[model samples]
Target chain A: MTEQRILHGADMLTERGRAEWDAAGVQVSALVDNPYKKDFPLLATKPSLAFLDSAATAQRPAVVLDAQRNFYESMNANALRGLYKLSVEATEAINASRAHVARFLGLTDADARDIIFCRNASEALNIVASSYGGSVLAAGDEVCITIMEHHSNLIPWQQVCERAGAKLVYMYVGEDGVLTEEEMRAKIGPKTKVVSAAHVSNVLGVENDIKLLASIAHEFGAVMVVDGAQSVPHLQVNVRDLDVDFFAFSAHKAFGPLGIGVLWGRHELLEAMPPFLTGGEMIDSVTEQAAVWAPTPEKFEAGTQDAAGIFALDAALTYMEGVGYEAIQMRESALVHTCMHRLADLDFVRIIGPADPALHHGVISFNVCGIHPHDVSSILDMDNVAIRAGHHCAQPLLAHLGIESCCRASLAFYNDSADIDKLISGLQHVWSMFHGD
Target chain B: MGEGIYNAALMEHNAHPDYKYEMENPTHTHEGVNPSCGDDIILSLRVVDGIVEEAAFTGSGCAVSQASADIMADLITEEPVEEVKRLCELFLAMIRGEACEEELEDLGEAAELKSIALMPARVKCAELGWRTALTIIEEEL
Candidate 1:
């Protein structure tokens, strides 16, 4: 067994959780065969493909597709408008999906109406920046974010701060690509009003201690907003345990259908902010003079929602719960360990992210010394291995590291050791093509 | 070696580029950047009496960009500035999948890159250096 499997087994060996694991028959081992791939229909069609770009977006499972198809087949009607049977059933299914999604994130309080659905993580972050950050930020206020944030999270804050004449501050990572506590304290000061960052960096694949960051932000009277697009899919997240003010993620990255995302915020803060969009069902009362907006969640979601995607997201959460996060971690850690060790043996390969493979949950970024990353990926594509190569929308971080671009190989639970071997072999082919001088 | 994009001629130019260096006191110079992939190229020409006496380039990019720039530098040396511009326009047309009527004997090894038209994503990479050279003569001169 790998160290990750041992550690995972130890966490679940307690008397109470042991019974749950036993009842579920969850196998606590570094996955050798990729048992979860059978559920993902995309892999079945492309049998020869070695997909290493899960960080961009993951392949959807069959259950998620079936749920979406079933919604369109049976409950195909506009929700919240009609009183007929099909419309009512569609509305009920959507509402039930909302409840299920909330429960998946450990937001179980019946009275807490904190979940608001949107298009993707980008739109969700925009809601917080425009609606919440726009209303509160002013000339002297500062919005603090990390340098490793995706463009989606960074640009929205820049727009809001530029409009309000507030300062945009960045907490930078060190040479090892890990954000330290000392840097956080130095960057986040008394003037900080909103502290936003990624729970797990998309390129670096290193998880930040958001719980500690939230505590520190609270000490400075700043609200914490987390981009959980990369973190929530691979790890077990309890929103209440982190005590964050707002959290956002996408469904497509977590083996669900696309066009569905979520923004979860505390009820009081959400109620204090104005609506992000205003139309049809989002209005309580409308007149020629002025309009009264609806409640917290409905006020943020104005137009017609993607009901089919929401239903599929509910199925995705259920599927993840069935496989469990522990197994997911063990499987990915083994693959990372295998791939990183092989990559490290090559003299020309320079690995990014942390030194320890444990720190890199499922993503690893690397660069060949004399070869451009785009060339590396192009050669690898000929071998049917898909990887991402570019600045990866984190151009600021790449500039800080003094690199133009790099190649990234990210993993999902459906991946196994064979995928890692193919990635290594493909990289060798890239070397042979470029380094035969 | 795989046969499609990284052929032997392209790889030879990229491996040991004769003109891949900065020139001293060039008549014209231009830098081009591809923001999509962050590939950059600097084209420098030593022109004398309306002719390119010597040509050299310095930059970093993919195999396509580097090889195309090196081959373009070798072709433009000792040619008239007007002829260099014509060759650049012809090369751009070839990479854009247009029909080539002119005999590109002056282009030398660069004519072999006509197959680059099939790889649409890399057309910009192969054209960066030629475009930079054209920009220098058209605007700077």
Candidate 2:
């Protein structure tokens, strides 16, 4: 028996099994020892850090940092302007970033033309609500959104509905954070002109069935808009397969830099809708009185774009592609399963979403009995375990769950079993601190 | 676990808060919410003949916030409304760690929350009820 085989102590093993155990030990040790502390330069300084807040924002890899630095140092110039070679390089880099995002989202060339780069997912959702839903939706029209939507998705529709004299219909989520097919059909009626829901709920961590929701919307002649912020990073999302009319996500949440977001809309809808924001690059021609807007994406991208950030975002997408969706999904699933199983052992830990980890992707929300989530988070922070606590910007959903707030431990591809162990210990500490055990 | 921000006095007040109940009839009731953590409270006061007759609070919050409100209610009851407002200002200052010994002594057990200043994130949690009391008193005046 080899050293690794003896250390793990599985069912009586052969020589070949011992060798495989040795190799597996090396791989797991790399993840357990360093976790994301090495891959992401941000955590390099904190050797024993445990970051379980990836649901808020992920730590960027060294490559993403290097890509941003390369853009600023080597090809620092304004994109889509100037005739110099440097300008052309900068512009090409931005376009390349767009192409990378399109390929990552599995969009075709025609669909790629409809992709609009905005500030963040909130801006992308606003673009749809203001430009498309605002102009087209008339009085008596209905906009359907789920109760589990973040305020970014909820408030915008509320504003649009009030301004247009339209009605805002809500589809309720079950106790398990799932919308039934019956609820989808019932809420989305003939008067429904737009249907918006998150592909995966940030707080609930439950992945919604976008294909089914889209089909229901299409039957009513309503366009389907998906908030892909919580889903795109953890899962393999093909926009074409989902057949969603509009999909919005933040680059920062997907291991990319901040100030860069993506909005993927149907080409036909982009052609029909007016521009969201108008400025220099967005105008094809201007004669003081009359200004002709540029086509599709350019008409929407106003002001100076974050070219360096876009380059970093492209690097992030490239890094994700290198890791591949299958590997990412498998790693995240195992980690979440370990977490759910362990948290389940603690009776005080009341999980807010689905009981099964398979229903979730990379996030878990729970609250400890007799301890406020804020207090729990504070105690955990003392142990160097970073977690998110509060309404998670889904107050309506929290209210529906009969909780004011919850403590969320979100994972990433870089996290491992060690991180989960640390979280469990931190939670135990919180309980002891509060309950005086 | 025994020490730090969750001190003995805070825990004592949180576990068996003397003033954590609704008043039979209140002249003023103010609802306060800390949107950050969802710490909410309903502070009710009975002011009659220019004197604070009774003060009570009912809420769900962290120990610091709920205990702080309970302590405030206990200290301010039966005092003149003007004196109650003065005590509220003193308590707020003490929690911010800006009050002198004489000012803190005026606040009674609420002065124990002076350590809250160290935890800036929780300063709001300790002051939600106090701020609500100020708003109610100001409206009455």
Candidate 3:
């Protein structure tokens, strides 16, 4: 007989707490079958687990974790604050990481200085909404965005428009999930000053034609802002190619350390906009009554930055580079295709976003007919299949789509067929658990 | 691994909640919302003097929220004011695993949701109706 272990709880879920493992290990017979699965420690340890919420946050690889530890072990100092060797090294690490991110996004080395580190994409977007929008926006002007914006992009503009006495406009999508040019033209008129959109929808997994949106915004003499939080992980997004005025993304969503986000703006725009935050190291010179701020990136990075997270982001970009865009896209496409086909096989399942699986960029949202997503999610959890079951922070989009909540299973290149199969079976189990009587 | 957790009492209460209806001009009403899960309920109570004349709820939510609302509405209706408050306190405490065996026994069928304390994610769902009921009647008392 093989020895087994029981994990106790003050009041363990009699059902879920029944996870018992034999001498080999916890659910050894049920470990996920994927080469990439081994790279993520959480997936590897929880072998039967299928994490399909990359749009929320992706799991970190060993290299990214090591990069964070190495930064603290070797040279953990405040960047741009001291002349000591350790501090200099920290500053250089941040500079190198910024350059790496710029190059990854196809920005010129000179444009590297335009990248500002913030808490996350939400904060990055808030900076633009406050500093840039606060400066350019005037009464009676209009700020146009899509009905499908994540709350991070939507709320900032909504509040900014309200504060500036400007009207907030929206570009609606058809049932096909595409924002037509006619709608764009109607909404983005001469009075429109800002046009912000998500490059990829976190809920729909549909890619918006941001290049076209940027051109139209430019035609109207408006600046375009792209929320690349969802796009950066799945696609090869080039900032210069898209030609948007500002771009924002978070590091944690790209398999990097937490609390690190990037906001890249045109150098001239960033230079003219007042600082979003005020503090030490962001100023060139300070007096009792007045202060001269530092140039570009440093002017925006006010407080003590996340030095270790910045250094670790360098590893994340390097890892993505090593994987190459072609391979990442191909692998993720196959996963999504297989998943969509299998889910369609279940008649009870109704997909929420784009009907075409090919159009999805590593994300899928659906609902089991007549069953609440929260209940669906709880049943799936019992089988160790994780998914997001809520409004996805896009209340406007959900209201527009006429759904209170949905189940989103976003994939990354690391996910494999075993994860998809487990998810399908878990969903079937959910259906039967509710109706098996 | 166990069977009783999902079937019968839980699923029946959710699928066919008899008390899920809007009360006409209720004596007290409150909207309970679990923002994260999108669980929302408008709990309505019709009270006369010191006794609850009727209790009902109208909303959408997960199985736990819907079932718990229906169950709580069924148990609290036609009960005295002070007795209703005691039952609500007992039910909430029982779901939280803080109430003793005797207090849990006083909770009637709501004690079936005791497992929710272990399932931390659903604790809010189970407490939605009781919390709303407590808040609506709290000021008057």
Q: TM-scores, in order shown?
A: 0.91, 0.91, 0.92
Better model by lDDT: candidate 2 vs candidate 3: 3
Ranking by DockQ: 3, 1, 2
Interface RMSD value for candidate 3, one decimal? 5.0
Please write out the lDDT profile of model 1 over residues A1-437, one tens digit for every residue: 11332222223233433333334454434434567788988887787788999989999999999999999999989998899999999888888888887787888746336889999999999999999999999999999999999999999999999999999999999877788899899988899999999999999999988998898899999999999999988888888999899999999999988889899999999999999877878889999999998887888889899999988998998999899998787667766766677688677899997977778878899999889998898888887899999999999999988998999999988986567666776777788777652
**Per-residue error (Å), model 1, residue A66:** 1.8
Worst 10 residues of 3 chain A by lDDT: A1-10
The residue-by-residue lDDT of candidate 2 on A304-329, one tens digit each, is 89999999999999988888888787
In candidate 2, stretches whose alpha carbon ends up further than 4 angstroms from where it belongs are A1-36, A109-111, B1-3, B48-53, B94-97, B100-102
lDDT of 3 by residue, A1-437 (tens): 01121221212122221232122122322223345677778878887788998999999988999999999999998888889999999999999999998998898777789999999999999999999999999999999999999999989998999999999999999876789999999899899999999999999999999999999999999999999999999999899999999999999999998999999999999999999999987999999999999998989999899999999999999988888888777677767766776687788999988887778998899999988898888888877889999899999899889989999999998887678767877787888778871
Write down the C-alpha DockQ for each prediction. 0.44, 0.37, 0.45
Give the 10-residue window scoring lowest on summed lDDT in candidate 2 chain B. B1-10
RMSD of 3: 7.1
- In Å, residue A187's CA in model 2 sits off its true spot by 2.0
In candidate 3, list every pair of residues with a backbone clash: none
Candidate 3 Cα deviation (angstroms), residue A348: 1.0
Which residue pairs show backbone clashes in model 2?
none
